[model samples]
Target: MSLSLVLLFLNFFTPQFNEAGQAKLEKMVKDRDALTAQWKASESQKSGIFGNRTKKDMIETNEWLERIIKKDNLIMDELRMIGDIETITATQTGDDYKAIAFKQEKDVQALKRAVAERDKQLKEKLSERRTFEWISLILFLISLGLGFVVYKKVIKP
Candidate 1:
Protein backbone atom coordinates (compact mmCIF):
# COMPACT_ATOMS: atom_id res chain seq x y z
CA MET A 1 0.00 0.00 0.00
CA SER A 2 1.00 3.64 -0.31
CA LEU A 3 1.16 3.96 3.46
CA SER A 4 3.61 1.04 3.72
CA LEU A 5 5.76 2.60 0.98
CA VAL A 6 5.79 5.90 2.86
CA LEU A 7 6.85 4.15 6.04
CA LEU A 8 9.62 2.37 4.14
CA PHE A 9 10.88 5.65 2.76
CA LEU A 10 10.96 7.24 6.19
CA ASN A 11 12.68 4.24 7.75
CA PHE A 12 15.42 4.12 5.13
CA PHE A 13 15.92 7.83 4.49
CA THR A 14 15.14 9.73 7.66
CA PRO A 15 18.49 9.05 9.33
CA GLN A 16 20.34 9.96 6.12
CA PHE A 17 18.18 13.07 5.69
CA ASN A 18 19.70 14.74 8.74
CA GLU A 19 22.60 12.33 9.21
CA ALA A 20 21.32 11.71 12.72
CA GLY A 21 21.71 8.58 14.80
CA GLN A 22 18.99 6.01 15.45
CA ALA A 23 18.41 7.34 18.98
CA LYS A 24 17.88 10.88 17.67
CA LEU A 25 15.42 9.60 15.06
CA GLU A 26 13.46 7.77 17.73
CA LYS A 27 13.33 10.88 19.89
CA MET A 28 12.08 12.91 16.95
CA VAL A 29 9.29 10.39 16.29
CA LYS A 30 8.20 10.56 19.95
CA ASP A 31 8.16 14.35 19.82
CA ARG A 32 6.14 14.28 16.58
CA ASP A 33 3.53 11.98 18.13
CA ALA A 34 3.23 14.16 21.23
CA LEU A 35 2.73 17.27 19.09
CA THR A 36 0.11 15.53 16.97
CA ALA A 37 -1.83 14.45 20.08
CA GLN A 38 -1.71 18.00 21.44
CA TRP A 39 -2.93 19.44 18.14
CA LYS A 40 -5.85 17.01 17.92
CA ALA A 41 -6.89 17.60 21.49
CA SER A 42 -6.82 21.34 21.08
CA GLU A 43 -8.85 21.12 17.87
CA SER A 44 -11.62 19.03 19.49
CA GLN A 45 -12.34 21.71 22.11
CA LYS A 46 -15.50 23.72 21.58
CA SER A 47 -15.10 27.48 21.18
CA GLY A 48 -16.84 29.28 24.05
CA ILE A 49 -16.67 32.50 25.99
CA PHE A 50 -13.23 31.37 27.18
CA GLY A 51 -11.86 31.29 23.61
CA ASN A 52 -11.16 27.49 23.47
CA ARG A 53 -7.82 27.05 25.40
CA THR A 54 -6.95 27.19 29.09
CA LYS A 55 -3.62 28.50 30.41
CA LYS A 56 -2.37 24.93 30.98
CA ASP A 57 -3.01 24.07 27.33
CA MET A 58 -1.10 27.17 26.24
CA ILE A 59 1.85 26.21 28.43
CA GLU A 60 1.91 22.68 27.04
CA THR A 61 1.82 24.02 23.53
CA ASN A 62 4.70 26.34 24.34
CA GLU A 63 6.77 23.39 25.60
CA TRP A 64 6.12 21.48 22.38
CA LEU A 65 7.17 24.48 20.34
CA GLU A 66 10.41 24.72 22.27
CA ARG A 67 11.08 21.03 21.68
CA ILE A 68 10.55 21.47 17.94
CA ILE A 69 12.92 24.40 17.89
CA LYS A 70 15.62 22.38 19.66
CA LYS A 71 15.25 19.59 17.09
CA ASP A 72 15.58 22.09 14.24
CA ASN A 73 18.74 23.54 15.81
CA LEU A 74 20.27 20.09 16.14
CA ILE A 75 19.59 19.39 12.44
CA MET A 76 21.22 22.67 11.51
CA ASP A 77 24.30 21.78 13.53
CA GLU A 78 24.59 18.45 11.70
CA LEU A 79 24.33 20.21 8.33
CA ARG A 80 27.10 22.63 9.31
CA MET A 81 29.32 19.71 10.33
CA ILE A 82 28.81 18.07 6.91
CA GLY A 83 29.73 21.30 5.18
CA ASP A 84 32.88 21.64 7.25
CA ILE A 85 33.94 18.10 6.41
CA GLU A 86 33.52 18.78 2.70
CA THR A 87 35.56 21.95 2.92
CA ILE A 88 38.38 20.18 4.73
CA THR A 89 38.43 17.41 2.13
CA ALA A 90 38.65 19.93 -0.71
CA THR A 91 41.49 21.80 0.96
CA GLN A 92 43.46 18.59 1.57
CA THR A 93 43.06 17.53 -2.05
CA GLY A 94 44.24 20.91 -3.29
CA ASP A 95 47.29 20.79 -1.04
CA ASP A 96 48.21 17.33 -2.32
CA TYR A 97 47.98 18.52 -5.91
CA LYS A 98 50.21 21.50 -5.16
CA ALA A 99 52.81 19.25 -3.52
CA ILE A 100 52.95 16.99 -6.56
CA ALA A 101 53.33 19.96 -8.88
CA PHE A 102 56.13 21.36 -6.74
CA LYS A 103 58.03 18.06 -6.71
CA GLN A 104 57.77 17.75 -10.49
CA GLU A 105 59.05 21.31 -10.94
CA LYS A 106 62.02 20.60 -8.73
CA ASP A 107 62.84 17.49 -10.73
CA VAL A 108 62.71 19.43 -13.98
CA GLN A 109 65.03 22.12 -12.61
CA ALA A 110 67.52 19.50 -11.43
CA LEU A 111 67.56 17.84 -14.87
CA LYS A 112 68.15 21.19 -16.58
CA ARG A 113 71.07 21.99 -14.28
CA ALA A 114 72.64 18.57 -14.94
CA VAL A 115 72.38 19.00 -18.69
CA ALA A 116 73.97 22.48 -18.55
CA GLU A 117 76.93 21.17 -16.47
CA ARG A 118 77.47 18.30 -18.93
CA ASP A 119 77.47 20.72 -21.87
CA LYS A 120 80.02 22.93 -20.12
CA GLN A 121 82.38 19.99 -19.51
CA LEU A 122 82.10 18.90 -23.12
CA LYS A 123 82.97 22.41 -24.35
CA GLU A 124 86.05 22.53 -22.07
CA LYS A 125 87.28 19.16 -23.38
CA LEU A 126 86.76 20.24 -27.00
CA SER A 127 88.76 23.47 -26.46
CA GLU A 128 91.65 21.52 -24.87
CA ARG A 129 91.73 19.10 -27.85
CA ARG A 130 91.83 21.99 -30.37
CA THR A 131 94.78 23.60 -28.52
CA PHE A 132 96.72 20.34 -28.57
CA GLU A 133 96.13 19.90 -32.32
CA TRP A 134 97.35 23.48 -33.07
CA ILE A 135 100.58 22.96 -31.00
CA SER A 136 101.35 19.66 -32.75
CA LEU A 137 100.91 21.23 -36.22
CA ILE A 138 103.28 24.13 -35.36
CA LEU A 139 105.99 21.82 -33.97
CA PHE A 140 105.92 19.64 -37.11
CA LEU A 141 106.40 22.68 -39.40
CA ILE A 142 109.37 23.96 -37.36
CA SER A 143 111.12 20.58 -37.48
CA LEU A 144 110.82 20.44 -41.28
CA GLY A 145 112.38 23.92 -41.62
CA LEU A 146 115.33 22.88 -39.35
CA GLY A 147 115.95 19.74 -41.43
CA PHE A 148 116.18 21.78 -44.64
CA VAL A 149 118.70 24.22 -43.09
CA VAL A 150 120.91 21.37 -41.78
CA TYR A 151 121.03 19.72 -45.24
CA LYS A 152 122.16 22.96 -46.97
CA LYS A 153 124.80 24.01 -44.47
CA VAL A 154 126.35 20.75 -43.27
CA ILE A 155 125.82 18.11 -45.96
CA LYS A 156 126.63 20.42 -48.97
CA PRO A 157 129.85 21.68 -47.36
Candidate 2:
Protein backbone atom coordinates (compact mmCIF):
# COMPACT_ATOMS: atom_id res chain seq x y z
CA MET A 1 0.00 0.00 0.00
CA SER A 2 2.84 2.39 0.68
CA LEU A 3 4.28 1.52 -2.67
CA SER A 4 0.96 2.28 -4.32
CA LEU A 5 0.80 5.61 -2.59
CA VAL A 6 4.31 6.45 -3.68
CA LEU A 7 3.39 5.62 -7.25
CA LEU A 8 0.35 7.84 -7.02
CA PHE A 9 2.40 10.71 -5.64
CA LEU A 10 4.94 10.36 -8.41
CA ASN A 11 2.20 10.35 -11.01
CA PHE A 12 0.83 13.62 -9.68
CA PHE A 13 4.14 15.33 -8.91
CA THR A 14 6.03 14.67 -12.15
CA PRO A 15 3.58 16.66 -14.29
CA GLN A 16 3.63 19.53 -11.81
CA PHE A 17 7.43 19.55 -11.88
CA ASN A 18 7.40 19.69 -15.66
CA GLU A 19 4.84 22.50 -15.68
CA ALA A 20 6.88 24.61 -13.26
CA GLY A 21 10.00 24.21 -15.38
CA GLN A 22 8.08 25.12 -18.52
CA ALA A 23 6.60 28.23 -16.88
CA LYS A 24 10.05 29.41 -15.85
CA LEU A 25 11.35 28.88 -19.37
CA GLU A 26 8.42 30.79 -20.84
CA LYS A 27 9.03 33.70 -18.47
CA MET A 28 12.68 33.79 -19.47
CA VAL A 29 11.74 33.94 -23.14
CA LYS A 30 9.32 36.78 -22.50
CA ASP A 31 12.01 38.72 -20.63
CA ARG A 32 14.44 38.24 -23.49
CA ASP A 33 11.90 39.46 -26.04
CA ALA A 34 11.09 42.55 -23.98
CA LEU A 35 14.77 43.39 -23.64
CA THR A 36 15.32 42.99 -27.39
CA ALA A 37 12.44 45.29 -28.13
CA GLN A 38 13.78 47.92 -25.75
CA TRP A 39 17.23 47.73 -27.31
CA LYS A 40 15.79 48.22 -30.81
CA ALA A 41 13.73 51.21 -29.72
CA SER A 42 16.75 52.83 -28.11
CA GLU A 43 18.88 52.24 -31.23
CA SER A 44 16.37 54.20 -33.31
CA GLN A 45 16.69 57.27 -31.03
CA LYS A 46 18.85 60.27 -32.06
CA SER A 47 22.10 61.13 -30.21
CA GLY A 48 21.52 64.03 -27.87
CA ILE A 49 24.30 66.54 -26.98
CA PHE A 50 25.22 64.83 -23.69
CA GLY A 51 24.81 61.28 -25.15
CA ASN A 52 23.30 60.32 -21.81
CA ARG A 53 20.71 58.15 -23.54
CA THR A 54 23.46 55.85 -24.91
CA LYS A 55 24.98 55.36 -21.49
CA LYS A 56 21.62 54.56 -19.95
CA ASP A 57 20.95 51.98 -22.67
CA MET A 58 24.30 50.30 -22.02
CA ILE A 59 23.58 50.07 -18.29
CA GLU A 60 20.13 48.58 -18.94
CA THR A 61 21.68 46.07 -21.34
CA ASN A 62 24.20 45.01 -18.75
CA GLU A 63 21.47 44.52 -16.15
CA TRP A 64 19.41 42.45 -18.58
CA LEU A 65 22.41 40.21 -19.32
CA GLU A 66 22.98 39.64 -15.62
CA ARG A 67 19.33 38.76 -15.06
CA ILE A 68 19.40 36.30 -17.95
CA ILE A 69 22.49 34.63 -16.52
CA LYS A 70 20.89 34.32 -13.08
CA LYS A 71 17.74 32.80 -14.50
CA ASP A 72 19.76 30.25 -16.52
CA ASN A 73 21.68 29.24 -13.42
CA LEU A 74 18.43 28.85 -11.51
CA ILE A 75 17.01 26.64 -14.24
CA MET A 76 20.11 24.46 -14.27
CA ASP A 77 19.93 24.05 -10.52
CA GLU A 78 16.27 22.99 -10.78
CA LEU A 79 17.16 20.43 -13.44
CA ARG A 80 19.82 18.94 -11.19
CA MET A 81 17.42 18.72 -8.30
CA ILE A 82 14.90 16.94 -10.51
CA GLY A 83 17.57 14.47 -11.52
CA ASP A 84 18.42 13.72 -7.89
CA ILE A 85 14.76 13.22 -7.03
CA GLU A 86 14.42 10.75 -9.91
CA THR A 87 17.39 8.77 -8.66
CA ILE A 88 15.99 8.55 -5.15
CA THR A 89 12.55 7.56 -6.35
CA ALA A 90 14.01 4.80 -8.47
CA THR A 91 15.92 3.38 -5.55
CA GLN A 92 12.90 3.49 -3.25
CA THR A 93 10.67 1.83 -5.81
CA GLY A 94 13.15 -0.98 -6.25
CA ASP A 95 13.19 -1.59 -2.52
CA ASP A 96 9.41 -1.64 -2.42
CA TYR A 97 9.27 -4.27 -5.16
CA LYS A 98 11.69 -6.46 -3.24
CA ALA A 99 9.61 -6.17 -0.08
CA ILE A 100 6.42 -7.13 -1.89
CA ALA A 101 8.11 -10.13 -3.46
CA PHE A 102 9.44 -11.30 -0.13
CA LYS A 103 6.03 -10.96 1.50
CA GLN A 104 4.39 -12.99 -1.25
CA GLU A 105 6.92 -15.74 -0.82
CA LYS A 106 6.22 -15.90 2.91
CA ASP A 107 2.47 -16.04 2.29
CA VAL A 108 2.95 -18.87 -0.17
CA GLN A 109 4.95 -20.88 2.34
CA ALA A 110 2.32 -20.33 5.02
CA LEU A 111 -0.43 -21.55 2.70
CA LYS A 112 1.54 -24.68 1.86
CA ARG A 113 1.96 -25.47 5.53
CA ALA A 114 -1.77 -25.01 6.15
CA VAL A 115 -2.65 -27.30 3.26
CA ALA A 116 -0.28 -29.97 4.51
CA GLU A 117 -1.82 -29.81 7.99
CA ARG A 118 -5.35 -30.14 6.59
CA ASP A 119 -4.37 -33.19 4.54
CA LYS A 120 -2.90 -34.89 7.54
CA GLN A 121 -6.06 -34.27 9.57
CA LEU A 122 -8.24 -35.62 6.77
CA LYS A 123 -6.17 -38.79 6.51
CA GLU A 124 -6.36 -39.37 10.25
CA LYS A 125 -10.16 -38.98 10.22
CA LEU A 126 -10.51 -41.45 7.34
CA SER A 127 -8.33 -44.01 9.14
CA GLU A 128 -10.45 -43.73 12.33
CA ARG A 129 -13.70 -44.21 10.34
CA ARG A 130 -12.31 -47.32 8.62
CA THR A 131 -11.33 -48.82 11.96
CA PHE A 132 -14.86 -48.23 13.34
CA GLU A 133 -16.44 -49.88 10.28
CA TRP A 134 -14.30 -53.03 10.65
CA ILE A 135 -15.14 -53.40 14.36
CA SER A 136 -18.91 -53.10 13.66
CA LEU A 137 -18.72 -55.77 10.93
CA ILE A 138 -16.90 -58.23 13.20
CA LEU A 139 -19.50 -57.77 15.99
CA PHE A 140 -22.42 -58.37 13.60
CA LEU A 141 -20.92 -61.60 12.23
CA ILE A 142 -20.37 -63.02 15.76
CA SER A 143 -23.96 -62.38 16.79
CA LEU A 144 -25.32 -64.04 13.63
CA GLY A 145 -23.23 -67.19 14.18
CA LEU A 146 -24.44 -67.54 17.82
CA GLY A 147 -28.09 -67.17 16.76
CA PHE A 148 -27.74 -69.90 14.13
CA VAL A 149 -26.23 -72.38 16.54
CA VAL A 150 -28.96 -71.86 19.18
CA TYR A 151 -31.73 -72.25 16.56
CA LYS A 152 -30.39 -75.56 15.22
CA LYS A 153 -29.90 -77.20 18.63
CA VAL A 154 -33.34 -76.21 20.05
CA ILE A 155 -35.35 -76.80 16.89
CA LYS A 156 -33.77 -80.17 15.99
CA PRO A 157 -34.14 -81.61 19.54
Candidate 3:
Protein backbone atom coordinates (compact mmCIF):
# COMPACT_ATOMS: atom_id res chain seq x y z
CA MET A 1 0.00 0.00 0.00
CA SER A 2 2.81 2.37 0.92
CA LEU A 3 4.71 1.40 -2.20
CA SER A 4 1.72 2.29 -4.35
CA LEU A 5 1.41 5.61 -2.61
CA VAL A 6 5.08 6.33 -3.28
CA LEU A 7 4.65 5.45 -6.95
CA LEU A 8 1.58 7.65 -7.23
CA PHE A 9 3.55 10.49 -5.67
CA LEU A 10 6.43 9.96 -8.12
CA ASN A 11 4.12 9.68 -11.14
CA PHE A 12 3.19 13.35 -11.03
CA PHE A 13 6.79 14.42 -11.59
CA THR A 14 7.28 12.20 -14.62
CA PRO A 15 7.11 13.43 -18.23
CA GLN A 16 4.46 10.90 -19.22
CA PHE A 17 1.81 12.84 -17.39
CA ASN A 18 2.84 15.99 -19.26
CA GLU A 19 2.87 14.42 -22.70
CA ALA A 20 -0.80 15.18 -23.33
CA GLY A 21 -0.25 18.71 -22.02
CA GLN A 22 2.73 19.19 -24.31
CA ALA A 23 0.69 18.09 -27.28
CA LYS A 24 -2.14 20.44 -26.43
CA LEU A 25 0.34 23.32 -26.03
CA GLU A 26 1.90 22.48 -29.41
CA LYS A 27 -1.54 22.48 -31.04
CA MET A 28 -2.34 25.87 -29.53
CA VAL A 29 0.96 27.33 -30.81
CA LYS A 30 0.31 26.01 -34.29
CA ASP A 31 -3.19 27.39 -34.30
CA ARG A 32 -1.86 30.77 -33.13
CA ASP A 33 0.73 30.80 -35.86
CA ALA A 34 -1.87 30.02 -38.49
CA LEU A 35 -4.16 32.73 -37.15
CA THR A 36 -1.29 35.24 -37.30
CA ALA A 37 -0.53 34.33 -40.87
CA GLN A 38 -4.20 34.69 -41.85
CA TRP A 39 -4.37 38.08 -40.12
CA LYS A 40 -1.29 39.30 -42.00
CA ALA A 41 -2.72 38.17 -45.31
CA SER A 42 -6.00 39.96 -44.62
CA GLU A 43 -4.15 43.13 -43.64
CA SER A 44 -2.12 43.01 -46.87
CA GLN A 45 -5.28 42.55 -48.91
CA LYS A 46 -7.00 45.47 -47.15
CA SER A 47 -3.93 47.65 -47.81
CA GLY A 48 -4.00 46.81 -51.47
CA ILE A 49 -7.60 47.99 -51.65
CA PHE A 50 -6.72 51.48 -50.28
CA GLY A 51 -5.66 53.03 -53.57
CA ASN A 52 -8.96 52.27 -55.32
CA ARG A 53 -11.25 54.05 -52.76
CA THR A 54 -14.42 52.78 -54.44
CA LYS A 55 -17.66 51.46 -52.86
CA LYS A 56 -16.80 47.96 -54.18
CA ASP A 57 -13.35 48.15 -52.62
CA MET A 58 -14.86 49.17 -49.25
CA ILE A 59 -17.37 46.31 -49.40
CA GLU A 60 -14.63 43.79 -50.17
CA THR A 61 -12.48 45.07 -47.30
CA ASN A 62 -15.40 44.88 -44.87
CA GLU A 63 -16.17 41.33 -45.96
CA TRP A 64 -12.55 40.29 -45.45
CA LEU A 65 -12.52 41.83 -41.97
CA GLU A 66 -15.76 40.05 -41.06
CA ARG A 67 -14.41 36.71 -42.21
CA ILE A 68 -11.17 37.29 -40.28
CA ILE A 69 -13.10 38.15 -37.15
CA LYS A 70 -15.17 34.96 -37.41
CA LYS A 71 -12.08 32.82 -37.87
CA ASP A 72 -10.44 34.58 -34.92
CA ASN A 73 -13.48 33.80 -32.75
CA LEU A 74 -13.29 30.12 -33.66
CA ILE A 75 -9.58 30.00 -32.82
CA MET A 76 -10.23 31.76 -29.53
CA ASP A 77 -12.89 29.17 -28.65
CA GLU A 78 -10.44 26.35 -29.29
CA LEU A 79 -7.83 28.03 -27.09
CA ARG A 80 -10.41 28.48 -24.37
CA MET A 81 -11.31 24.80 -24.45
CA ILE A 82 -7.64 23.89 -24.16
CA GLY A 83 -7.25 26.25 -21.23
CA ASP A 84 -10.26 24.69 -19.48
CA ILE A 85 -8.85 21.20 -19.85
CA GLU A 86 -5.53 22.32 -18.39
CA THR A 87 -7.30 23.97 -15.47
CA ILE A 88 -9.26 20.82 -14.64
CA THR A 89 -6.14 18.65 -14.77
CA ALA A 90 -4.32 21.07 -12.49
CA THR A 91 -7.19 21.05 -9.99
CA GLN A 92 -7.26 17.25 -9.88
CA THR A 93 -3.50 17.06 -9.36
CA GLY A 94 -3.74 19.62 -6.57
CA ASP A 95 -6.47 17.59 -4.88
CA ASP A 96 -4.34 14.45 -5.06
CA TYR A 97 -1.42 16.26 -3.46
CA LYS A 98 -3.61 17.61 -0.69
CA ALA A 99 -4.89 14.12 0.13
CA ILE A 100 -1.35 12.72 0.30
CA ALA A 101 -0.22 15.60 2.50
CA PHE A 102 -3.15 15.08 4.86
CA LYS A 103 -2.34 11.41 5.22
CA GLN A 104 1.29 12.17 5.98
CA GLU A 105 0.28 14.73 8.60
CA LYS A 106 -1.97 12.18 10.30
CA ASP A 107 0.84 9.66 10.37
CA VAL A 108 3.18 12.21 11.94
CA GLN A 109 0.63 13.05 14.61
CA ALA A 110 0.19 9.38 15.48
CA LEU A 111 3.96 8.90 15.86
CA LYS A 112 4.18 11.99 18.07
CA ARG A 113 1.45 10.66 20.37
CA ALA A 114 3.24 7.31 20.65
CA VAL A 115 6.51 9.03 21.55
CA ALA A 116 4.75 11.23 24.18
CA GLU A 117 3.14 8.19 25.79
CA ARG A 118 6.49 6.39 25.93
CA ASP A 119 8.15 9.44 27.52
CA LYS A 120 5.40 9.73 30.14
CA GLN A 121 5.86 6.06 31.12
CA LEU A 122 9.63 6.52 31.40
CA LYS A 123 9.17 9.52 33.70
CA GLU A 124 6.82 7.60 35.97
CA LYS A 125 9.31 4.72 36.24
CA LEU A 126 12.14 7.15 37.04
CA SER A 127 10.06 8.76 39.84
CA GLU A 128 9.28 5.35 41.31
CA ARG A 129 13.00 4.44 41.29
CA ARG A 130 13.87 7.67 43.13
CA THR A 131 11.24 6.96 45.81
CA PHE A 132 12.55 3.43 46.31
CA GLU A 133 16.13 4.71 46.72
CA TRP A 134 15.05 7.30 49.32
CA ILE A 135 13.20 4.65 51.32
CA SER A 136 16.19 2.25 51.26
CA LEU A 137 18.55 5.01 52.45
CA ILE A 138 16.25 5.88 55.40
CA LEU A 139 15.99 2.23 56.48
CA PHE A 140 19.79 1.76 56.36
CA LEU A 141 20.39 4.88 58.51
CA ILE A 142 17.80 3.71 61.13
CA SER A 143 19.48 0.31 61.43
CA LEU A 144 22.93 1.87 61.98
CA GLY A 145 21.58 4.23 64.68
CA LEU A 146 19.92 1.30 66.54
CA GLY A 147 23.17 -0.73 66.45
CA PHE A 148 25.10 2.24 67.95
CA VAL A 149 22.51 2.64 70.74
CA VAL A 150 22.79 -1.11 71.62
CA TYR A 151 26.62 -0.89 71.78
CA LYS A 152 26.51 2.10 74.19
CA LYS A 153 23.79 0.74 76.52
CA VAL A 154 24.74 -2.96 76.69
CA ILE A 155 28.52 -3.01 76.22
CA LYS A 156 29.60 0.22 77.88
CA PRO A 157 27.21 0.10 80.90
Candidate 4:
Protein backbone atom coordinates (compact mmCIF):
# COMPACT_ATOMS: atom_id res chain seq x y z
CA MET A 1 0.00 0.00 0.00
CA SER A 2 2.82 2.40 0.74
CA LEU A 3 4.42 1.54 -2.56
CA SER A 4 1.13 2.10 -4.31
CA LEU A 5 0.66 5.45 -2.59
CA VAL A 6 4.14 6.58 -3.58
CA LEU A 7 3.62 5.44 -7.13
CA LEU A 8 0.32 7.24 -7.30
CA PHE A 9 1.97 10.40 -6.03
CA LEU A 10 4.69 10.04 -8.65
CA ASN A 11 2.09 9.59 -11.35
CA PHE A 12 0.24 12.66 -10.09
CA PHE A 13 3.40 14.72 -10.28
CA THR A 14 4.24 13.60 -13.82
CA PRO A 15 1.25 15.25 -15.47
CA GLN A 16 1.64 18.47 -13.52
CA PHE A 17 5.23 18.61 -14.69
CA ASN A 18 4.35 17.98 -18.30
CA GLU A 19 1.44 20.36 -18.28
CA ALA A 20 3.50 23.12 -16.75
CA GLY A 21 6.24 22.59 -19.33
CA GLN A 22 3.86 22.60 -22.28
CA ALA A 23 2.11 25.76 -21.14
CA LYS A 24 5.43 27.52 -20.73
CA LEU A 25 6.61 26.35 -24.15
CA GLU A 26 3.47 27.66 -25.80
CA LYS A 27 3.83 31.02 -24.09
CA MET A 28 7.45 31.25 -25.17
CA VAL A 29 6.54 30.58 -28.75
CA LYS A 30 3.87 33.24 -28.60
CA ASP A 31 6.40 35.74 -27.30
CA ARG A 32 8.79 34.82 -30.06
CA ASP A 33 6.13 35.56 -32.65
CA ALA A 34 5.37 38.86 -30.96
CA LEU A 35 9.06 39.78 -31.01
CA THR A 36 9.31 38.98 -34.68
CA ALA A 37 6.28 41.07 -35.50
CA GLN A 38 7.60 43.97 -33.45
CA TRP A 39 10.94 43.75 -35.21
CA LYS A 40 9.29 43.88 -38.65
CA ALA A 41 7.21 46.89 -37.64
CA SER A 42 10.27 48.70 -36.30
CA GLU A 43 12.23 47.94 -39.45
CA SER A 44 9.45 49.34 -41.62
CA GLN A 45 9.35 52.51 -39.55
CA LYS A 46 13.11 52.82 -39.80
CA SER A 47 12.95 52.54 -43.56
CA GLY A 48 10.26 55.19 -43.67
CA ILE A 49 12.42 57.51 -41.52
CA PHE A 50 15.38 57.06 -43.84
CA GLY A 51 13.36 57.57 -47.02
CA ASN A 52 12.70 61.28 -46.32
CA ARG A 53 14.78 63.36 -43.91
CA THR A 54 13.29 66.83 -43.15
CA LYS A 55 12.00 68.69 -40.04
CA LYS A 56 8.68 66.89 -40.46
CA ASP A 57 10.63 63.73 -41.18
CA MET A 58 12.66 64.26 -37.99
CA ILE A 59 9.45 64.49 -35.92
CA GLU A 60 8.12 61.40 -37.66
CA THR A 61 11.38 59.56 -37.06
CA ASN A 62 11.24 60.51 -33.38
CA GLU A 63 7.73 59.06 -33.20
CA TRP A 64 8.92 56.00 -35.06
CA LEU A 65 11.83 55.62 -32.63
CA GLU A 66 9.39 55.92 -29.72
CA ARG A 67 7.25 53.16 -31.21
CA ILE A 68 10.32 51.00 -31.65
CA ILE A 69 11.29 51.52 -28.04
CA LYS A 70 7.80 50.62 -26.89
CA LYS A 71 7.84 47.50 -28.99
CA ASP A 72 11.28 46.61 -27.62
CA ASN A 73 10.02 47.07 -24.08
CA LEU A 74 7.03 44.86 -24.82
CA ILE A 75 9.32 42.15 -26.13
CA MET A 76 11.54 42.50 -23.06
CA ASP A 77 8.60 42.20 -20.69
CA GLU A 78 7.15 39.19 -22.47
CA LEU A 79 10.57 37.59 -22.46
CA ARG A 80 10.79 38.11 -18.72
CA MET A 81 7.38 36.55 -18.07
CA ILE A 82 8.21 33.65 -20.34
CA GLY A 83 11.50 33.20 -18.51
CA ASP A 84 9.74 33.02 -15.13
CA ILE A 85 7.15 30.52 -16.34
CA GLU A 86 9.81 28.34 -17.96
CA THR A 87 11.94 28.45 -14.80
CA ILE A 88 9.07 27.38 -12.61
CA THR A 89 8.14 24.69 -15.10
CA ALA A 90 11.71 23.43 -15.55
CA THR A 91 12.11 22.95 -11.81
CA GLN A 92 9.13 20.61 -11.98
CA THR A 93 10.41 18.57 -14.94
CA GLY A 94 14.03 17.81 -15.85
CA ASP A 95 13.19 18.05 -19.54
CA ASP A 96 15.87 19.34 -21.89
CA TYR A 97 13.05 20.79 -23.91
CA LYS A 98 12.59 23.11 -20.97
CA ALA A 99 16.08 24.45 -21.58
CA ILE A 100 15.26 24.96 -25.23
CA ALA A 101 12.10 26.70 -24.26
CA PHE A 102 14.03 28.93 -21.90
CA LYS A 103 16.40 29.85 -24.68
CA GLN A 104 13.49 30.60 -26.94
CA GLU A 105 11.96 32.68 -24.14
CA LYS A 106 14.85 35.02 -23.49
CA ASP A 107 18.59 35.73 -23.71
CA VAL A 108 21.31 34.22 -21.51
CA GLN A 109 20.86 36.60 -18.56
CA ALA A 110 17.21 35.66 -18.22
CA LEU A 111 18.05 31.99 -18.57
CA LYS A 112 20.65 32.36 -15.80
CA ARG A 113 18.08 33.73 -13.38
CA ALA A 114 15.62 30.99 -14.33
CA VAL A 115 18.21 28.28 -13.87
CA ALA A 116 19.31 29.73 -10.54
CA GLU A 117 15.79 29.93 -9.20
CA ARG A 118 15.08 26.40 -10.32
CA ASP A 119 18.25 25.05 -8.81
CA LYS A 120 17.72 26.95 -5.56
CA GLN A 121 14.19 25.65 -5.16
CA LEU A 122 15.30 22.11 -5.94
CA LYS A 123 18.05 22.34 -3.32
CA GLU A 124 15.62 23.58 -0.70
CA LYS A 125 13.21 20.74 -1.39
CA LEU A 126 15.98 18.18 -1.25
CA SER A 127 17.19 19.62 2.04
CA GLU A 128 13.69 19.43 3.45
CA ARG A 129 13.35 15.81 2.37
CA ARG A 130 16.68 14.93 3.93
CA THR A 131 15.66 16.55 7.20
CA PHE A 132 12.34 14.73 7.18
CA GLU A 133 14.05 11.39 6.54
CA TRP A 134 16.48 11.91 9.41
CA ILE A 135 13.71 12.93 11.81
CA SER A 136 11.61 9.93 10.80
CA LEU A 137 14.53 7.58 11.29
CA ILE A 138 15.17 8.95 14.78
CA LEU A 139 11.51 8.62 15.74
CA PHE A 140 11.34 5.07 14.39
CA LEU A 141 14.47 4.02 16.32
CA ILE A 142 13.17 5.52 19.57
CA SER A 143 9.83 3.80 19.16
CA LEU A 144 11.49 0.44 18.47
CA GLY A 145 13.77 0.80 21.48
CA LEU A 146 10.86 1.71 23.75
CA GLY A 147 8.86 -1.27 22.48
CA PHE A 148 11.79 -3.60 23.12
CA VAL A 149 12.13 -2.32 26.70
CA VAL A 150 8.39 -2.82 27.30
CA TYR A 151 8.57 -6.35 25.94
CA LYS A 152 11.48 -7.32 28.23
CA LYS A 153 9.80 -5.86 31.34
CA VAL A 154 6.24 -7.02 30.78
CA ILE A 155 6.20 -10.04 28.49
CA LYS A 156 9.64 -11.71 28.36
CA PRO A 157 10.65 -14.87 30.27
Top lDDT model: 2
Residues 35-141 of candidate 2: C-alpha lDDT, one tens digit per residue: 66766665655455665456666676666667667766776776777677777767777887898899999999999999999999999999999999999999889
- Two-way TM-score contest, 1 vs 3, winner: 1
Name the lDDT of candidate 4: 0.68
How would you order the candidates by lDDT, starting with the best?
A: 2, 3, 1, 4
Tens-place lDDT per residue, model 3, 4-67, is: 5755765665444457656765776676577667656655553345454566556765776676
| Candidates, ranked, TM-score | 1, 3, 2, 4
C-alpha RMSD (angstroms) for model 3:
5.3
Span of ten consecutive residues with least summed lDDT in model 2: 44-53
Q: Measured by TM-score, how close is model 3 to the native structure?
A: 0.57
Candidate 2 has which clashing residue pairs, if any?
none
Clashes of 4: 0
Off by over 4 Å in 2: 1-3, 18-78
Off by over 4 Å in 3: 1-74
**lDDT scores for all predictions?**
0.71, 0.77, 0.72, 0.68
TM-score on alpha carbons, each prediction: 0.60, 0.57, 0.57, 0.33
Cα-based RMSD of candidate 2: 5.8
Task: State in Å the error of residue 60, model 4.
Answer: 50
**Model 2 score (lDDT):** 0.77
Candidate 1 residue pairs in clash (backbone atoms < 3 Å): none
